[model samples]
Target: MDYYNGHEDFLDRIEKLNAIGIALSSQRNAPALLEMILQGAKSILNADGGTLYLASEDKQHLIFEIIINDSLEIMMGGTTGVSIPFDPLPLYDREGKPNNNMVAAYAAINHKTINIPDAYVAEGFDFSGTRAFDRKTGYRSQSFITVPMQNHESELIGVLQLINAKDPRTGAIIPFSEQSRSLAESLASQAAIALSNNRLIQEFRQLFESFIELMAEAIDVKSPYNGKHCRRVPDLTMMIAEAVCKANYGIFKDFSMTEEELYELKIAGLLHDCGKVTTPVHVIDKATKLQTIFDRIHLIDTRFEVLKRDAEIEFLNQKLAALESGNPQNVPSLEAKFQQKIQQLNSDRTFLQKCNIGGEFMRDDLKERVLQIAKYEWVDTEGKLSPFLNENEVYNLNISRGTLTPEERQIINDHIVVTINMLTKLPYPKNLRRVPEYAGGHHERMDGKGYPKGLTREQMSVPARMMGIADIFEALSSDDRPYKDAKTLTECLQILGKMKQENHIDPDLFDLFVNEKVYLRYAEKYLHEYQIDQVDLTKIPGYTPPAV
Candidate 1:
């Protein structure tokens, strides 16, 4: 007997179908959407079992997405997470003929609905596997309505198959009525459209992320010393941001980021250094102060060689003049003086070599010595005497800190301004409107003493502040930087804490960063074993233990 009456039940199922259709349209997740569609169709017809198979990307086969057999207490796939162990059904035979022997495949190929009174007696279709399943489970396979799911464009997306429609009053299995089958077909059409839309969205999202990562790789690759700084910074930024959200006891305990905000921050992290794309390769790759297209230290090296040669030439000339004047004793004195000059020149050359490395602070004494070396005269290849170190070379060797001169440092800092200009001009979605603000503010100091806009802590967003910390920590901890030695875990935290105290970084983020151990997580992944020396939190400048 039929369960659905052509009147009241039909109208009620129609209402459910409408509600399910609306719900299906709003679903963004793919698995949940398929579950809803299958569950919705089952609820409408009171189905005891069902299966949903979507066409593969190549459309050569129908892949098993979900299967449910309520009578046998079996529920698999979708939200239940139980995978269907069955192999995908092929859509064509070896001879290239359509596979009409399987009901689901036949529905997909023909774009038609299949209504069967009983699987055991079904004609022109193979029920051997169905009977085998029934025997193994001690169950009866009967009364199936398989509908091909197609979008509004009339493209087949999948097949929605239902089994054992039960009479509602007596719980007896019955054939699907014409009206029930019609409603099932309608539900399948809605489901197909929803699935198609989600796939399109997922593909677009994947494409956007891939493009962002590619650009980040390009920026990082531009500088050999900073190898993966662009990649590592974003990862550390997210780790810090997530720690803030999960912090049970902290200044940011009440703060939270939505999914959209998290994604926007992630995008901002990946693109924070996008402006580096416009930065000069020479400036970015400046491993030493004397480095331009090549290290100018080599030129200074040639000049040092000339100075040594000039000393030897003077010694030989003096020796020859002394001998010619019949005073060989004067030649001995001249030779000793020449040896002292050679030793002094050797010492000065070594000192200049150390200064050119640009690793440690260039003290006032060191700068004066570099200028004094510039006063030494050496004969050029053209036989003209010139200062061993030129004005520009002296200035470079006298740099107070890491590789860059003031003008080049300004050029490096200007990348943030360029980043802001580039991102601000684009039409970002409303959710991501703050990308430029977040990326641009990474260079700004908490006390308004830093770059471009000089934004103080209160003027910046939390994510921007988080980015600043991440950027600094990555640079400090990186092993490949030519300007500095590889910093240990303790050293990194010490510098970060000192920066926090100096108002160079956000205080709350610093506290959360140190106390929550986000730095440890990052170091474990990116830093070398030698750089992972035991960190003493108590000794770190701004680190305070969480209140008990």
Candidate 2:
């Protein structure tokens, strides 16, 4: 019997040795290191309850950190799901002065293990207001063993506490063995080293998020259209990426991206139009068909004055005829004719004011009349007759139609290039290296017609394509737009489908998109109920109503 007992002790010692080795190997990350220690300690001391407390930088009082009991109810004391404020509480001095129960302080200040044989009967221990903790929680005041986790350099890391190490079969708590205390203190030392490394990484990540916010805001404040675009794009981009991941689209099935990568993609979407910072606001918010700074309808007024002068000549000729006939004809008067012509011209120019308010289309002939009334001859502020617009400018002005000029179109396109330039110059995280590529590629067509780099279908990432779609969708459905009323859902989708058919978009992605019902998901989330309610079935060209 004695020989058998000796063999069992040897095996138990080996098991504990392996456990400590496993815990030490977990030095790669702080949280993982702490969890490993908890798991190891639970197995080592055979305790049902365990808690790990990280020391504050100042090593004052120990605060509640992570609890790993089977019930995990200790976290209910209100530390879960909150960022614990980093405040150092005062620690008790070894000479019986009040000291904080922080593991680092206990280990560093006392340089010894704190083992309570019976917490309920312990003298000179402060259980003061924490009695409520025991009463409400049903946690008996029994034995506890705490040790400071430290590194080889004697740096204080954190504190580890094990509660109720019990005598098996008797179901009674027992004080920790000296050997167990030594092993735990050794483990704590290893954990301290891990904690320091983790804190450094966390600080770096926070700094990165701050930079992202500043860059995103700078891009937003630069343009009116892009003002709220940044905020909305990130929200929408992340949602789409999540949906795409859930859909398990091909190679992405096994492709697991980290949270940092996802964040980078979102930032890229937010600053996709950062180049707009260089774009003039006047051009971005241009309201007129041929607008630069101001529409030249005033010049059209000059043409009307010319026409008024011609009418005066004709009126005088009529008066001369009456005089030649020797008939008494009172001249209708010089100023009267001039005033009449001015009144007619003013009426024509002012007739279309309310018409463009809600995008009320003019009759073809009437639109031409409005255009003729606007065609005026005038010198610039420089007193020079500007060079007559060429065919391209005339086409953009679309006198017969109505919309932005071609020069303005190029100016808008240049914003994407600017976006690329601005982002590319900044040193970003590795995952966000593609920010400029994705943002600049938004305007590019799948068929190689896109500007800047003109990346084709295969060159684009899923995120870039999704951002493009989201951007178009938002613009189409935006009721706050100055020119056009928000298009109904059906109208927007049909336009998107047509663009897809024209080889401007990814047909395969579009098919998966409609098949997976991406747009419906987006509509339910971002768009208003009325917008969805107004989706006219008939307006979706070639879409037949399903049989009920």
Candidate 3:
């Protein structure tokens, strides 16, 4: 009221408007931004009430977004946690004519600002709803200004309707001046652009998330076994991270993750195994030592059949010759020798089959048996004798752990290296700059003995260490792996505890993981019912429960 003794100063309002514009442009959240826009517009004019309506996506209606009634102390939508009970106002009738009867719609449809000094006497717009509201609430509705919110291209984004401009000097209701209308129009323009930019950013985020999902789908199609690992690891990662966040007694008691930081961890978890896409599916899905495009144990079985057939042929030939030479008594010994050879061959074949099966560890004795079995000779198709097990078959059959040879294991480990290489080149936002670090560091060990970068515990972030534990736990308890049986919860925690003792994983994190029972939390969600067996904390190696 400094300018006209009863009105707001024009210069001060302009400066305030510029500041509000800056604030609007910087806000990233949609609801907060919409709420800011309405509040900013009202503050400039000291308006008593306002209700912002946005054009619906279908363009057939105006949807209420933020509603405020200062005298009644009623606020809804935006960030208020209160919802508007009103439905969207139709922009057109069922017969497809412009709905000019509604004041907000008229301003939006005509791209004109409607300035009513008093709504009770305003013409050409419906005030029946306003009258009904006033009658119900016993409050007078007066002094309206409806401004069309449009972008630089003059496309209507929404309508900003201010109610009852108050005299700064006396607090009496006054008509919105021409200056007020102009300022409101300019503010709506700025707010629209801000909203548009935020929406564009949101859409891009959605597209990026969708791309991640598509990558997951590709992995599923590439190898379903690994696909399950891909999904469950993230879940388990978050479970541990959250437990750390809520820790009340460990080294992690002071640790916490903001929403943005947790979101970064989550994205990293989702992308941790993304480079597995480049891994060969055969090597990734190798279920048995002698497995290639198919299991080679069957080939060994056929060779055993040929060896038995040869032994039978030789026995029959010798027996017939003995009978021809009038030594029929030799037939029983020949038959006994043949039967013994057949039994030995059957036993050797059975042993080789067991050796072909994969497990966590292969015994030295079993490996030596494979080597001795490899020395057995068989007739080749060209009539030349050849060793029963070729060099490659012997190597595959003698895999010391799981189904993969050292070379195949290296090929599998290269996936983490590939993940690092791929993510290092990605252009994540500043807030998510640590995604590559978190995702690629999962395979690293506390003692710098793990693969790729081999980050030590102190050299890595807590989240990366957390990811390592999650990766191990998920692999341990997961039944979907091609090489190992689904381990019980106790078994999984026992391995983690040993890893901690050996400096393969962070000790503090392992303690927290055990004390908090992050493994059981994960097991309940991802493990099979049988895998969720009784867990005894006292027996977990290198792990001690926190004192109560």
Candidate 4:
């Protein structure tokens, strides 16, 4: 009957150990896992208190990771919001000798467990600090079970120390049983494996996030004008996404994002412009209509100077010919003609200079004049007559909208396609599978007229649509773009409202944007002081202020 009773108790302990192992395996958080490990050992051995110490990276010291004392009602570290102020215990003495005097350090250094029945009378180990702690707390320090936490490779990762086991029947301090020590050692081994796995997973996550940010930085570095674009877009995207999730009444009322989803969206935003790295710098930074490797306007200026010099030379030759023919009276008329020619040339030069700049709109008459200027003749370096503006130059100067020519605009727009292709090739996990779709669809429009895939508002996901609004708003209000100055908050809202009216963007989102003042919040964070102008909500086209 005695043997059977002992066997039954052993089976009960084994069942508890199995349950504890399962719990440890499921815990992904490191601090919580450590706390659980210590708690499991204490419960198994009926220990009144415990401390878990993790070995430092250098393997010379064990740092206090978690401490729990049920008798003193003390709990520090491990999500308690209370910190351990004690110093780390060293595994070795100053002379590089193993510190076998300390029970916990001895276990870590020698790869063994130290089960002391009575710490006060224990030999060959230090208990001075433990006794001091007991004196301060007016509590007796007795039995101790120190277990070394070793990984699968038998590497010492940490130490688990439990103190003052209690007799269940008498409720008196007692020595930990041989069975209790065995259970603790087993628990420590499982805890070590769990902790190691959790740390490895967390390290991989941090490395992946850091690598994403690095790629975003690399894209920004390729163009000075877009230095913070990759960073700011994610901020705005999250802002808008969060706002959508908060709307109480609308199509987005039921919208919500989990923590993982939010993280995935943020990653997508960071990588949205990554393909811009492949975009030609000349096209990306084309500040003016005539800008390429350098501002070709300077070359045009030199041509104007040549034209003036030639006119002067012709005038001097005509004056000398009039003198030789005794027809000096015609010289004044000739001089008047030369002056008029110079004046006309100066006026045309000024006009061409003005046309070289990029603006929101370019009139047809201005485009016609650019073509006319292209027909003008100039003497080339090879002494041959050439059109003052070549075919490519004329096409560039006649750009109807922003600085980019049709071909250059196509090149710039191709980044979205490249972004899709690049991201699609990546072996993303299930949670991040939508990254390519979200990143690639930011440039798509509401009316099925947008780029690459021409995805309409109905076809795109809500997060992708949110990114589109963010991208447009950021571009409109950003002072960093090379081609234009930042628009005021008022101007940006008005343009966005007009886009809604034209079905260029989601009307519902635009309404939510204005009604919620998402733009104002973003302006306070990112926009310049001058750009944050007062906006009249009533005046914004197609935007009605929400009734208070």
Candidate 5:
């Protein structure tokens, strides 16, 4: 019967060890995994306390990772929020000798397990620190089992030390049995493998994320006016996404996002404008209607100078002819005519200069005047008569809206299509499969009037809609854009509200943006001080204040 009972106890320990192995293999979080490994080992051996130490990168010292003592009610590290204040245990002495005096160090250095019946009577090992700890707490220190955790490569990764094994029946301190030591060694081996795998996975993820951020940085560096745009958009996107998740009384009240899903959305935000790299710098930074490689208005100014010189020369010749004909009376009228012509030339020069600049609105009369100017004849450097403005110049200067000509505007808008194509070519993992959709949908409108795909509100995802808002708001409030000044909070909100009314953006999000004051929060972090102004909710078009 005693033999059978011993057999049963051995089988029970085997089951527990098997259970611990499974748990260690499946655990993903590093801190929690380390804690579980230590706790599992302690439970199998009925140890009063245990400490897990991970080897430092240089392999010169063992750093405390998790420490737990049930009898002393002490827990540090490994998700405990309390830190281990003790210094790391050195693996080698000053002379490069293995520190075998320390049991944990000895196990790590020799890659072997050391089982001590009683630490106080143990030979050739230092217990001074352990003794000191016991003295302060008035607790007895006995029986120790130290195991070296070696990975598949046969390299020591860490050390696991259990103290004061207890007798199950008497609850008295006892030495660890051979079976307990064997089980602990097995557990430590499994834990070492799990830890190595976890670290490898974490390093790979870090590399991937770093690569993504590098690409975003590359795009941002290409345009000085887009300072931190790729970085800030993701911040704003996540801010709105989180706000929507927390909201309980809107269309997004039931919406939610998992950690992986949130990461996917963030990646989309960072890569949204990546295709802008393919856009021409001239088009992207065109600050005026006459801007190309250089502002052509300067060239037009030179032509105006030529015309004025011709007028002055013609007047002088006419006066000379009149005087030669013995008629001095016509000289004053000729001088007056020359002065009037000079003044008209100056007035035309001023008008063209104003036309060269871009504005929010270009009236039809100004466009017609630009057309008329295009018809004026001028002598070219080659002594040939040419129109004051070329066909291309007329087209550019006559643009009735922003600086971009229709062709250039189309080129700028093609970036979204390029973005979609580029993202679609990437073989994204399951969690990030919607990257193309979210990144590409930012340009789409709620009324299906948007570009690339023209996805309406009904077809678009909440994250895509959120990104649209983020993109518009960031562009509106940014002081770095070459084309426009940073608009104040009131101006940006009013424009966004008008967009909401026109079905250019998500209406529900617009309401939340006003009610929750997301604009204010974003402004505080990223907007220029002057851009942040008093926003009047009542005056903002299409925005109704949420019920108090």
Candidate 6:
């Protein structure tokens, strides 16, 4: 009967240890996990009070973490509250002369469980001057059980201490039993393993977030106009994506993306313009219709002024000759003609600036004038004018559209190639390895008319197409550029819709975007009052369709 009873008691102890381990594992955060440890130790050992302490990195001290008690009494004169120390409590020297709480420290140092029956009356125990705490509270410190929480590698993580263990039936403070001490040790071991795993996961998440932040900042710093583009796109894209995700109802039944994946997508959206780092800043923020570095239009205006002054000089000389010959009447009409020519030149300069702002849309007639200005030859310091452009000189002069002069187009287009090259150099993990594939294809078209590789719709992934649209949308909606005002949402969508009709962008995504009112969500999140407010969507012709 005694043998059978002992086996059953051993099984009961195992069950309690497993239950406590399961409870400890359920906690996600550090505080809750520590609280579980304290409660489980109190319950397992039938202790009056228990305190869990975390070890400092140096392993020379105990840092009190959590304390559990049934009914705690406050002292009259004690200033420090019953809370654990805000800092680590240092261990004592070699002598056992009632120094600091060496029992807790010893457990952590040795990575072992220590049990002291009747701590106040134990042999070699000296409580001469340190008995003030017990005298004040009228509570005698008795049995103490300290167990080291060690990870799988036997590295000490922390210590757990149980004080004044009680007998459940008699309600009297009893010494900790051998079985209870064993159970506490086993529980501490399991808790340490679970905590180590949590720490590793949290560390990895922080590292990933840090990398994303650094990459976003680097991409923004690439160009002045692109400075705020990376920050705003993620804020806008996430709002739109989350709203659509919520509205899908049953459409997202099979879609099992977590908050983390969505966050990664937002990070990817912010980094979509990282390829622009390879693109020249001057090209990215090109202001004029025929602009590369310095605008020649101002130089052309100076030339026009010189031509008018020369004409005036010629007219004044003729007037002087006519007056000397007694024919001053001929001077009036000649002066009038000179003034008319000057007025015409001023009007033409105004027209060009307006034309430059209007250059967002392609027009054959305006484009011809733009090309004419781009082709104009400027005399170098040698007084020699050059016509044919070398590849390097193209970006040094005027361009008709976008950033690239005809010769610079290939160089600008190679940004995607650079993006592919740079990203492929890193051995990215499986999940993020496709970043290059997505970011590199942002400038590609669906009709095989894009630059570099000129990939068609059949070859592109949905993510690549999404990024392309996001890049364009952010560029259009952004007001950070000094060259052009932000395009109105109505105007932006209409342009994208036209691009879809021309087979340049994906038509399906366009429909999905408009029908779901995706741009409004984006505007609400990232756009300022100037970008979104007081705008009439109806004034935009193709933006608002007929009611039917």
| lDDT, candidates in the order shown | 0.89, 0.64, 0.88, 0.89, 0.90, 0.66
TM-score of every candidate relative to the true structure: 0.96, 0.70, 0.94, 0.92, 0.93, 0.69
Sort the predicted structures by TM-score, highest score first. Answer: 1, 3, 5, 4, 2, 6
**Using alpha carbons, what is the TM-score of model 5?**
0.93
- What's model 1's TM-score? 0.96
Mind giving the per-residue lDDT tens digits that candidate 5 earns over 271-291?
998888899988887878889
lDDT of each residue in 103-197, candidate 2, tens digit only: 33555567567887777777655664446667877767567788876665666666788877755556566776666676666656655655665
Error of 3 at 190 (Å): 1.6
lDDT of 4 by residue, 372-444 (tens): 8778888978899999889988888888888888888999999998999999999998989999999999989
Report lDDT (Cα) of residue 85, candidate 1: 92
Model 6, poorest ten-residue lDDT window?
Answer: 73-82
lDDT of 1: 0.89
Q: Over 4 Å off in model 5, which ranges?
A: 1-26, 322-333
**Candidate 4 Cα RMSD after full superposition onto the native fold (Å):** 2.7
The residue ranges of model 3 lying beyond 4 angstroms of the native Cα positions read: 1-8, 322-328
The alpha-carbon lDDT assigned to residue 547 of candidate 1 equals: 77
> In model 1, where do residues sit more than 4 Å from their true spots?
1-3
- Candidate 5, residue 303: lDDT: 96
Q: Write the per-residue lDDT of candidate 3 for residues 460-502, one digit (tens) a residue.
A: 9999998999888888887778877788988888898899899
- Candidate 5, number of clashes: 0
Quickly count the clashes in candidate 1. Answer: 0
lDDT of 6 at 320: 93
Predicted candidate 1 versus true structure: per-residue lDDT over 143-221, tens digit per residue: 9999998877787799999999998888899998998889998899888888989988789778988998999999888
